[model samples]
Target: MIPQKLEVLEQTEHKLVLVIEGISLEMINALRRIMLTEVPVMAIDEVIILKNDSPLYDEIISHRLGLIPLKTDLDVYKLPQECECGGFGCPLCQVSLTCEVSNATNAPLMIYSRDLKSNDPKINPVDPNIPIVKIDKNDKVIIEAYAILGLAKEHAKWQAVSNVAYRHYPLVEFDESSLKNPELNSLIVKMCPEKLFTMSNNNTLKLKDDYWRYCTLCMSCKNNSEGKITVSPKEDVYIFSIESDGVLEFKALLGQLFKIFNEKIDEFITNLEDLEIES
Candidate 1:
């Protein structure tokens, strides 16, 4: 099969949008599943509570910690199960974080994810505003947590992508000449939920590309226009978007995804070759 062509439309540290052509729907969906469940990320796996004066129990606090997204460095870290240390616990396989808070103020104090101090400066909470728990005056909470690289299949806390999905590229066509009537043009604008259509100075109906991805293909404009407007999807092209959990940059995540895909393909080919030889 010929290699697919990928064109990045927009990219940021946490979000990515791309146009992939010359690929089958099955291949695109497989990549989406891999991004959701196969990509490894660092998250709290173990917690040790030395003291607790808050309302939340030790187990509850530990569970909350596990859900917090932590920035990941794939180059420097290895999954505990795959590590040569036999899953015992090593700097390369696990990261240590400590949270110690003693509320001495007159009012209640809220503990946030930022309060958790990490031994490795590179690995920390993605958002500092996430609230862990609240403690009353003169109350205190002490805890130690261990983070390790893990896959989303084991737990959702390890999921690196939040909104990962793809859809067929939309194709919109409308007859500008038919839209000469001001009332019809106004109706078209009001019918579009995405507001993708606009009136130009030449009294022609124009479509904006900015919100085309948001189109639901409801065909409200087309149906009301007496067949003047048409909406369809491109068969071989897809628009893909992904929002990361900040554990890994979106670009790096895509790189890792392609690497994993290539490895799986190679393994499948090797297995097929062996079976043919046996036959």
Candidate 2:
């Protein structure tokens, strides 16, 4: 098979969209699964509650902490299971975060993930606004959290990508000559939920390309058009989109995913060679 061609349509720190050609759906789905489940990220793994005067139990607070997305540096850290410390605990595998709060005001004070102090400067909560718990006036809360490098397969908190999906590119065909009738044009425009159809100055139906991506393939336009319009999917090309969970940049996540893919391919080739040698 020929190699697939990947053309990046849009990219940002948190989101990416690409057009991939010459690839099968099964191969693309495997990459999506790996990005969602195999990507390594940092998240709170252990909690040591020193004090708790709030209504929430220690386990509840710990769960909240674990869900918070932490900044990850793959180059500087190692997965806990792979660390040389034997998984007991080490600076290379874990980070310590401490949160201490004593509400002195009359109003209820909200504790947020930003309140947690991390021993490592590089690993911290991605969103400071994530509320951990609410404490009434004169209440106190203290806790120690241990953040660790892990894979998303172990827990959702470690998932690097928030979403990964792909779909066939949309193809819309409209017979403008047949849509010259004002009544038919009005009907077509009215049937489109996305408002994709509009009337041109020449009194013919016009389709907007901007709304094509949001097409639901409901066949309303095709059904109402009476052979004036048709919609289909471009089977050979796919529109792919990915969303990051803030632990790693979208580009960084893609780089790591490609690295993993190459490694897996090499390992498969090596195993095949070994099997042939044995035969």
Candidate 3:
């Protein structure tokens, strides 16, 4: 059967939210952890292609980190001459911006790293201000932004400047006892083409949160000739929030859509495999 891509459920300048109808927070958090960590942090990742629509097309991979706008490295942006504190307070090394987030119940709070900003000539921020958003609260949303210039990795101070993304899989939950007796976890493990399923020493089969990034959501894991397992996506729980300086655009919209698509494809593949095994 031909697979179908769902329509854009919702969009925003900095976020895109969707519903998968019966998933779980545990599963969603699991998927988020994997996608955020495993997705590649390519130096140049985002590609914006303008089509017939005013918003344009923003294609993205969960693994793809933010783009490096500069063609060269940071040395080029440094001030040529020396300073009183030597390298301290150099104008070439800093830029400032603002960002704010409000009532982001559906999405997790994320911020960019400031230190890694590339010195490449082509690199430029659409907004000179940085991301400033409050997380998980309402009534007078939180707002903050400071100079986004630095080069340290893993330091919280460096995080003010780079865009990061979460994993793309819809949260799915299943009751293994709903399948067959002695629920064969091996059946689910074998169903994954991505090798996401694993067996524990205890002999109980449980879905690894890390594997969510690879989940095709094919529903093969759901197939139980003996009626022992039940799996479903959490669609009713919808959460939407984004914080950005500009108006909503395609990059933000499509980037999120791709994440949704990745999970759907996994589901389709898994479901198809499960059905085949039953047949």
Question: How many collisions per candidate?
Answer: 0, 0, 55
Which residue pairs collide, candidate 1?
none
TM-score of candidate 2 to 2 decimals: 0.90
Alpha carbon lDDT of residue 256, candidate 2? 90
Cα lDDT tens digits, model 2, 1-279, are: 243788888878788998888877787887898899988999999999999999999999999999999999998888978899989889888899999999999999999999999999889999989999999999999999999888889889899989999888778898788778887788888988988888977888888866557776777889988865778886767788998868998767878998888888899999988785743
Residue ranges of candidate 2 with Cα displaced over 4 Å: 1-8, 11-13, 274-279
Evaluated against the true structure, the overall lDDT of model 3 is: 0.39
Using lDDT as the yardstick, the better of models 2 and 3 is 2
Which scores better on lDDT, 1 or 2?
1
Error at 117, model 1, angstroms: 1.6
Evaluated against the true structure, the overall lDDT of model 1 is 0.89
| Residue 49 in model 3: lDDT | 25
Pairs clashing in candidate 2? none
Pick by lDDT: 1 or 3, better one: 1
9-93: candidate 3 lDDT, tens digit per residue = 4565554444343445565454454333322111322222222111111233111223322222233343222323354434454
